[model samples]
Target: MGKATGFLEFDRLSEQNIPPHERVKNYKEFVLHLTDEEAKVQGARCMDCGIPFCNNGCPVNNIIPDWNDLVYRQNWEEAIKVLHSTNNFPEFTGRICPAPCEAACTLNINSDAVGIKSIEHAIIDKAWELGLVKPQVADKKTGKKIAIVGSGPAGLAAAQQLARAGHDVDLMEKNDRIGGLLRYGIPDFKMEKSHIDRRMEQMAAEGVNFLTNHNVGENIHPDDLIKDYDAVILSGGAEWPRDLPVPGRELDGVHFAMDFLPSQNKVVAGDKLSEQILATDKHVVVIGGGDTGSDCVGTSNRHGAKSVTQFELMPQPPEKENKSMVWPYWPLKLRTSSSHEEGCDRDWSVATKELIGDNGVVKELVASRVEWKDGKMAEIPNSEFRIKADLVLLAMGFVSPQQSILEKFGVDKDARGNVKADTEGKKAYFTSRDKVFAAGDMRRGQSLVVWAIREGRQCAHAVDEYLMGSTSLPR
Candidate 1:
């Protein structure tokens, strides 16, 4: 610990944000990172707790206390070194990850947890400004070729690690751009696409080939990759969105959150789409109470929607958790995102009964209050209600990856339809098919970006070992 009594002397300092009224007018990041001194104070709050559960709490197992001590000592270069040693994309995690590490912090048992995410953001931004982030080009080539499908966090991490291990890596994306989900699934208002572009540039300098518009199952056959490359890794996301199967779901104005979100991201990137699903001057209803739903709220507000309302099928969680019972683990609690803070009418324990439409466009939503007992749901008697809705966005999360891709590769699938692959033991990340591997959402179903990165790094380590009969890459 940098300062033994620093936790007692300092109070938590939160990052600032642009006022909702002002930020809603445009699609750009509004949350401001902490200043150097503010970050220093926040970092100093890390206690001498003997054990750092935050490391285990993070999906990528970030060395939180070490970086906190470095930041407190103003060792900016070393802070990023420690950060990058574990996380390949701190900028992404620092901006959008839910920060489970904070929930597991020892200080969180009674006091506020240290702002580890904010410190990470500061360190990465400082590292970039100081030209400390650069390509780690390999000195010798391994004379092996590998193909990684999907350019999401997992694929990106795997490609970079394999490239650095002296292998020829081709990172492929089905879309016209890289960053499978990060390119479109996320809103630019939360994180600009420039961060992804910058990392791609660094990766290109490291000798990882970028192949866009390369749909494996559609245009590029699995046989070609199996024949041309020494090994193939599937890292695509869980793209099969869960649908609301009620009547009138065929209405024109109703769409999946993914279909609506990507259009805006493409427009922001200067791509001209002939038609966009806009929320302007319309009564918008977003179904589901997750990050995707919150993103819809934010984008609707930016589109100048007449009114925005969100619905959740589950009951609302408590505003605070009983830390004694849930210490060192993630707890279920009420979470209000920045988008919710901007402007949104949120309701829980409500289920949609049907969608009322006119002229093939959605016009109203019929829903009812429900109660849960013994993990079963029952609608309340005579609690049906109707709400005006011109546009309905379903953000209820994804169910699994596209089965077509897995079928084309002839790889075994789990019961949940994700590519069947283990994370430990001798056959780690290896699919039933010869020389084929899977990681991230493609193997583990839908999950956080940090977890995806962790799987990618571990999968790369496994692949390198399989190819060379041994590996020096970190797991």
Candidate 2:
């Protein structure tokens, strides 16, 4: 431990943000990182408990205590090393991850947990500033080839690991650019695309080839991958956004959150659009309260929306969790994201009845209060109301992986329509076809970026073992 009573002496501190008015003026990151002294104090808050539940809570199993101590001692180079030992992209996670590790901290029982995420942010930012992060190309060649479908977090992680193991790795993306969601789904204001570009450069230096605009299933055949590579790993994300098939669904202003968010990201990327889907000077209603919904709120604010409202089908969760009961586990509690703080009218226990429009453009949304009975949601008859909404973005979440790619591979699918792979037992990550494996959202359905990284790392080990009968890579 850095100090005997460090946990007792220091309190948790989060990163500061720019004023909402200032941030909404442009598309750029707004979080102001802690200074070195502040970061050290935050790091000192780690108890360094004998059994660190934070490790278990982290999907990537980062050595949280070790890095905390390292940063507390101002040993930033070592801190970065420890951080990178498990997570390949601390910058990405530091910016976007919800930090379940903090919830699972031993200190969280009484005192606040150490500022693990902020410490991580400081370490990575310092590493970048000092030019400490670099590519590590293999010294010896294994001469084995691997093809990874999808260039999202999962595919990138797997590709990097396999490339470092001396295997020839090709990371393929169906999109016009490399990053699947990271490049498009996420707004630049949350995490700029430069982060992805820098990592891509490092991966290229490490001998991992990236092929953009390659729709492996539609344009390139599954047979092509099998013939060219020893193994194929499917890491394509779960797309297929859940939809509302109510009355007036085909209205001009009603759109999917994915369709709405990506276009703004494209515009931020300097793409000029003749007729963009915008919320400017309009009343925007975002359906479904989640990260995507929060993102929509933020984007609409940026577009200068007249007003913004978000709806949650389920009732609102308690502001504070029952820590006694949910200790060391992620609890159900209200989470107000940065987007929510920007400005939003949030409603819970709401169900949309239909989109009300005139001349094929959305004018308002018809909705009603919902009550749960026997685990089923039913709209209350007399609680119906109409809210002005010039644009309606559906942020309900994804249903499954895109069926076209799954169909092309002819892989078995589970009842949820996710790619069928034994993620447990002896045949974990193995698809129905020989020499084919699936991971990330393709197998697990819609999930956090941390979960995707975990699956990617594990899938790499599975693939390595399948090829060489053993693997040094950590699962």
Candidate 3:
């Protein structure tokens, strides 16, 4: 450790965010990254806690204490080296990851965590500014051709790793653009597309081929990739949004979060859609209280919705967690997102009963408060309510990967519909079909971006080992 007493001397500090009112006016990143000195002080707060549970908390197992020490010493160069040793994309995780690592922080047991994510944001941003992030051209070619379907974090990570290992990597994307959810599903205000763009450039320089508008099982055939490529890796994320099966689900003006989110992202990227869904002056009701629902709230506010309200079926969690009961693990607690702060009426323990429409367009919705007992839910009698809603957005989260591609590939699927594949032992990541593998949301169901990167890197190593009988790629 750089300073044994540093943790005692310094307090935890995090990145500052712009006021919600001002930030919601436009779809742009509002988080102010930590300055160099602020980051150093935050880094100094990492205790000499020998275990570093933050590593286990992080999906990629980042070397936290070492980098914290390096950053506290102002050794920026080596800090990034330690960072890149485990996680391939720090900037993405730094910005959007929920930072489970912080919850597992030793300091968090008593006080605030060390602001590790902000330090990572600083390190990666500084590395790029100093031109420390450069392409690693392979010194030798293994003559193996690999096709990675879906250009999300998982696919991108695997492609970069395999290409750097001297293999020919072809990244296939169904959309016109490269990034999957990063390019479409996520709102621009949360994270700009330029981050994904820069990483794509780095991967391309390392000999990975980017093939956009290539929808396997549709415009492109899964058999084609299987026949031409030496190995096939599936990273296509879960795209199946869980639907509300209540009455009037087919009414007009009701849509899925994926449909609503991607349209705005396309508009931001200069695409013109004649039939774009808009919340302008509409009474918007977002269903489900997850990140997607919050995103709907933010976007609706940006579009000048007359009113915004969000509903959650589950009971509201406590604002604070009992650390003693759930230390070093992700605890269940109430989380208020920036969008909620922007302006939203939030109701918990409520579930939608039905959507009502006039002239075939949804005009209102009925809901009822629920009570849970013995692991089962029962509606509270006479607790029914109604809310005006000119537009309804379903953000109840994804159920599984879209079955089309998986069906076309004849890949075995788990009970939840994700492509079935194991993560341990030799031939790990191998799908039921020979010469095929699966990872990320496609295999594990919907998850965070950090976990996707970890799965991608590990899957890449598995593929490399299967092909060349050895692998140097990190797990």
Candidate 4:
């Protein structure tokens, strides 16, 4: 609601990316954020929708209109306040989230949607530049202790909220670093690790205790945490990657996406590995067409792979979605990542048949074109083919949280092997065990970072109310 006629006055403007040729040379952020004027113009494009379906579309329920108005008025300070009121880490989402908010915008019915994500990115970048982001230490210490296992987005968000609520919170992680998959699975080009480091600094100032390399049920006993803390929240993300179990699956060149991704991250952090699974001068075939698959393609290209190809089992979706049919909801459509721009041959309706190799080393992959009718998939007759693939990365998404952690806690799991917990009612976020709760990908299975942040914030409120019978933390 910037100008009432602002939508007509200004057109949607998106953030620009560095050229693919130049960006592929380095593992750094290539997307250039909008200037203050560009961001203000973009923010002004938001129409004063009576319902504001953008809010409904956002998983964290961000106040889009309020912030858009604020940004248009040049209230950078107030814009960050509103943005952070709901999102604990706007910087994370601003960089990587697929903005569903824009899709639900009223202007999207015909014209381009407001650049909400770009404005968000601008607001946060300015906030950091002006040093507006600071730790909010609790005025009083409640003395009650809480243990949160995992260091992913959900765990980090919950720990921050609980710490600010006058509670002593212990954030534990098995990895040597804080961000679970964010630190490893994601490429540095999407978001620099410094963002996580800054949050860690602020959280430390807020009295959140972090324990790294504390793998529960192994080095650390789960019973100790349950016994010592007044409450426990599990936010360990889904880590068990969905793997292809076919002939020659045990080949040396066939590796999970997690294995390939984490190694690259470690190298970027200056960890010299004697042996690393490299894609240099080798043809690669990634099995999956999701974000993770795109990441594999990008990483392989940076490594100077001879060729890159990606396969999706389902048929290709349309480049544009029917807004009339899927308005205010996530729609199926073709998505090409920045990595795809670097260079990748993508195919749909193709399924990997088998890994062909010699001496237990993957050299090629056999596949078949598939056709889907109703809900069934069938291989097309006489459509078998083969492609050279020295490296194979299975990026078919995760199936469940690592069973070892969930099993050790003895928490009940839903049919999908996720931690059994309701999102509503009096028992919200409460697990089968007393004083035990779960959130994030561990509870909801694999999902977007924005969704994980929402679950974390809500779960924190639920925990706070359960302990104190009242809470001020926003859900």
Which RMSD values do the candidates have, in order? 0.6, 1.1, 0.9, 0.8
lDDT of 3 by residue, 313-369 (tens): 999999999999999999999999888889999999998999999999999999999
Candidate 4 Cα errors over 4 Å, as ranges: none
Arrange candidates by TM-score, highest first: which order?
1, 4, 3, 2
Alpha-carbon local distance difference test for all models: 0.96, 0.92, 0.93, 0.93
lDDT of 1 at 83: 97
- Can you give the lDDT of residue 221 in candidate 1? 98
Model 1, range 1-475, lDDT digits (tens) per residue?
Answer: 8888999999999999999999998888998998999999999999989899999999999999999999999999899999999999999999999999999999999999988889898999899999999999999999999999999999999999999999999999999999999999999999999999999999999999999999999999998999999999999999999999998999989999999999999999999999999999999999999999999999999999999999999999999989999988999999999999999999999999999999898999999999999999999999999999999999999999999999999999999999999999989999999999999999999999999999999999999999999999998
Top of the candidates by lDDT: 1
- In model 3, which regions exceed 4 Å deviation? none
lDDT of 4 by residue, 1-475 (tens): 7688999988778789999999988899998999998888888888887999999889999999999999889899999999999999999999999999988888898888889999999999999999999999999999899999998999999999999999999999999999988898889989889999999999999999999999987999888999999999999989898989888898989998889988988899889999888899999999999999999999999999999999999899999999899987888999989999999999999989899899889999999999999989999999999999899999999999988888899999999899999999999999999999999999999999999999999999999999999999999
Worst 10 residues of 3 by lDDT: 5-14
The local distance difference test score of model 3 is 0.93
Residues 226-321, model 2: lDDT tens digits: 888999999999999999999999999999999999999888889888878999999999999999999999999999999999999999999998
Deviation in Å, model 1, residue 463 alpha carbon: 0.5
What are the TM-scores, per candidate, against the unseen true structure?
A: 0.99, 0.98, 0.99, 0.99
**What is candidate 4's TM-score against the reference?**
0.99
Better of 2 and 4 by TM-score: 4
